[model samples]
Target: MNLWSFLQDPASWVGPDGIGARIVEHLVYTGLSLLIATAVSVVLGVIVGHFRAGNLLVVGTSNAARAIPTLGLVVLVVTLLGTGITPVVLALTVLAIPPILNATSTGVREADPGAVHAARALGMTTWQVIWRVELPLATPLIVSGIRSATLQVVSTATVAALAASGGLGRLVVDGQRLGASGYPEMFAGAVLVAALAIVLDVALGSVVWGLRRRRSRIGRTAAELDSAPAAEATPA
Candidate 1:
């Protein structure tokens, strides 16, 4: 069960239970968890952040999510729901929502009040100020929260294998079942999960970079437009 031997085995990379299939399964499970978590957390976070209320709720929920062990939660949910992807997705979603919620809330609250006032003075409604003014300003921290949640979900998604949800973790679970004879498979599975997490984090970082760039461009555009009226009104 040497590492080299495992790499040389074409059967490991192809077919139903092979590496490729497992990767696809892993992505599906991970994607669904993120989508559901993001939808719920972002909406709630935006509302709370805009209102600047609910710090107790945010802090309490974040602490609670961190305290719950991912495997235990997944197992409990699977036990209640019967063996399926639904429970696993729920567990991973729980793991993801906290950071996103916290970050979005903080970002919104931290946005400059003067800018918010200006938007209001300009006849922007509360929703308009939030959407056009606050959200753009809060994009960086919101992305940061997403990146943190993404890393956590990518790592924890492996637990899905324990609930009969096929993923790259299948190799590790199978290897563990076979004991010493399956050491190489276990090692390969661990490596794959780590590599996958790294890849996902890097991808998220790029998204953050792009969002910041767009924000910067928007600021520059606004600055130029503001300066145009002043430059034209000059007495000289």
Candidate 2:
């Protein structure tokens, strides 16, 4: 069938329900997977990032997670959990955690020691030093990690369709079942996935940029405060 004919025949892309509904399903599955994965990884990463005791543990765990092959991990989860959204979510979360943990740990460990020391000198609590000094400096690296994790989750969520969770991957899988004539549908699914990745990456990147900008402003304000004359030294 021609591209025009395929477009006109809603069943090709949308299945029997229609294009809008299928698109919503694709987005819902993708969005939920990413959201859950991001939340879990970021929280775990941040907690692990804050202390020396947890550093080795976080690094070791993240490396192990990275070593697991995506398909193999998904298969294993499916075998244990049976086919459904939960197993797919668990698989994507596993794929996502490594980058987040690694980046967050690296960033926190490499945060500006001078600023951290100064915060400590001022009698700031440990949590204050972390929140005001370490986390700000580490924001960029954490953002990078999040960006990587988000992209990975988006790509892997498509595989969830294999377990009967509807997603854009249904188009590709169904097309493959129908043979070479279904190539266009497969290509279309690929295009949608690519577009989704790009959109999410750009959006997360903007958040990182904003964090960096805010950090810069905070640094400038701190510098100005440091240079200001002591209030008690002013002439009476």
Candidate 3:
């Protein structure tokens, strides 16, 4: 069966071993890893960026993480921990952290200095400034980083099947085991993963767009307010 035929067949999507089940498994892996990674990266990034410290730490760690081969890391982890969701999630969490950390660190560090100064002038506590001013302003970039991390995780999650874990990748791996007859399953699995990535990217892109629009509107409003008194005082 060709990829199209496989998709059209209802049987391919039903039952425990069907495409639907595999997709759910894939999402489970992705969600677990992303949840953990985002929490760790965002917190660390905020602290590092806000204090303007740990630049070397953030940069060095992110670079080192990026350099690690994810597949090899997964294999090694599985070897030590034994094959299961824990090992897969651990490897994936490592893979997902760097982009989010870097993006968040850069975003918070570069939050409008004027805004930070204004926040300080208002007698806002340091934490208040972070929660109210810096974080809101930095949201777009943070989300963008998450988007990048998500794509990486989705693509790499396929390797879970190698460790006897469940996911859409199982289709590809199982298809390979079946030799030439499994080409359709492999193609279908690849296509599904790509589709999932594109859909998620589009969704996250919309969030980024909305955030930018809100930021632009806020900027324009601030500019108008600042000019209003000057405009009134000027000679007509």
Candidate 4:
């Protein structure tokens, strides 16, 4: 069957082994990895960015993480931990950490220095400054990092099927196993994965855009207020 035929077949999208089920499995893997990676990355990034400490450590870890190949890491992890979701999650989480950590750290570090100073001038503690001033300013970059990490995880989660775990990758691997006759299914799997990535990217982009627009509006309002002449002091 051709790619269209494969996709059009009702059997392709229903039942236990159907595309729908596989997509769900793929999302599970992606979601779990992102949750763990985001939680860890955000905390570390906050500490590093807010205090301006751990720069070398974060840089080293991000570099090392980006250097590792995702599929190979998955295979190696499975070999040591035995094939299961745990190994898969661990590998994917590793794949996801660098982008989030870097984005978050950069965002936090680059937050408005004036705002930080003002927050401090108000006697807000370091933690308060981070929570109230730095993080909010850094939100755009942090969200961008999450968006990037999410896309990476979505694309790489297909490797989950390599561990005999069921996901959209199962179709591609199965098609490969079946030779020429399976080409349609393989193509279909690839298409679906690409579509999923595009959808997620657009969605995240909208969020980033909205955040920037809101920030811009706030900046404009603040600027206008600052520039506006104070009412002439009434004669005492």
Candidate 5:
């Protein structure tokens, strides 16, 4: 069947028990992997970003992780852990960590040194400087890292189907096994995966944009507060 025929076949993707359920399952797996990866990577990144010595270890580990090919890593995990969601989650989580850790560390390190220095000069504790000054400034970069990790996880999670965890990739693999006429089915699966990735990227981007806007508004408010006394003392 051609693309149009595939599109017209409602039963193919939307019946009571069809590709739709599998797609949802794929999304669930991807989401869970990303959530776990983000939590771990962000916390580790923050801790490493706060200290000079730890930063080296974080960067080195992140780089090493990124160097491991996704397919190879998936195969290795599957071999060790057996097939199903567990192996898939483990592989995807490993794939996601590097971007998050790198972005978070970069953001924290790039935060205004002057602000940090002033906080320390004021007798603020190390934790206080990190919590009150460094983290706020690093929010944008940290969010960007999350967005990157999320996109990676969504795309790669499809590989889970290869290990017997049903997903859009299952449709592709099964269709290919069925021969040339199965091209439409494979194409449909690819299109669905791409669409899902785009939607996720766009949604996460909007969230990051919202966060940046809030940060900007907060900065403006602080500026206005700083100028308020000067304005009041000036001639009316």
Candidate 6:
């Protein structure tokens, strides 16, 4: 089959079981996994990081997560749950959690101590200090974790197609089953996966850029205030 044949086929782009449906399926799996991972990991991470407690637990969890293979986890869950969205979402969420947890914990722990102390000195509550000073400053690395997790989830979600589920990966799996005759279809699927990954990554990066810019503004404002008293005292 010609590559153009599959690429040009209007049928592939429309209808209930077409590329559009598959893309939507992929997105749902990815979005759900990211949400679950972020909610669970970030909360725990922030608490641990803020209090500086359970360092060993955080490090061990991160390492353990890294050691577990995503594909194996997906397959294992599917075997027990027997197909459908549940197993897939669970597996993907597990896959997405580690990096996010690591980032959140590290980011908060590493935030400028002066700023954190200043917030505390101002009578800000623990929650206020975390929300205002820590989170804003730690945002860069947190976003980095989220972005990494997003890409991981998107990639892993492809395995859903293997379990008779819908995703862009179905194209590759189906095409491979067709052998050499399906190369064009397989190529098309692979291309779509790469393209989707790039688009998502760039989108997340843009958000990070905006956060960093805001953080910089806050930093500059604080610096100006610090210099104000010095400037007044230095006047001839």
| Candidate 2, residue 68: how far the Cα is off, in Å | 1.3
Candidate 1 C-alpha lDDT tens digits along 86-163: 888888888888998888888788776666666766678989988997889788878888889878887888888889
Q: Model 5: per-residue lDDT, tens digit, 9-105? A: 8888775336888788888888888889888976777787888558878888888998998889989999999998899988999888899889877
What TM-score would you give candidate 4 relative to the actual structure? 0.91
lDDT of 4 at 44: 96
Report residue 96 deviation for candidate 4 (angstroms): 0.5
Provide the RMSD of all predictions against the true structure, rounded to 1 decimal: 2.4, 3.2, 2.5, 2.8, 3.4, 2.3
| lDDT of the candidates, in the order given | 0.83, 0.74, 0.90, 0.86, 0.80, 0.86
Off by over 4 Å in 1: 220-236
Tens-digit per-residue lDDT, 132-188, candidate 4: 777877788888998999898888989899997877899999999999999999999
Clash counts for all predictions: 0, 0, 0, 0, 0, 0
Q: Estimate each model's TM-score.
A: 0.89, 0.82, 0.93, 0.91, 0.86, 0.91
What is model 2's C-alpha RMSD?
3.2
Ranked by TM-score, the better of candidates 5 and 6 is 6
Please write out the lDDT profile of model 2 over residues 13-37, one tens digit for every residue: 4545344555566667666766776
Q: How far is candidate 4 from the true structure (C-alpha RMSD, Å)?
A: 2.8
Segments of candidate 5 deviating more than 4 angstroms = 15-17, 114-125, 220-236
- Positional deviation of residue 230's Cα in model 6 after best superposition, in angstroms: 9.0
lDDT of 5 at 232: 78
Candidates by lDDT, descending order? 3, 4, 6, 1, 5, 2
- Candidates 2 and 4: which is better by TM-score? 4
Q: Judge candidate 5 at residue 212 and give its lDDT.
A: 82
Ranked by TM-score, the better of candidates 1 and 3 is 3
For residues 43-72, write the lDDT of model 3, one tens digit per residue. 999999999898898889998999999889
Better-scoring candidate (TM-score), 1 or 2: 1
Q: In candidate 4, how many Å is residue 61 off?
A: 1.3
Best-fitting candidate, scored by TM-score: 3
Best by lDDT: 3
**Candidate 1 clashing pairs?**
none
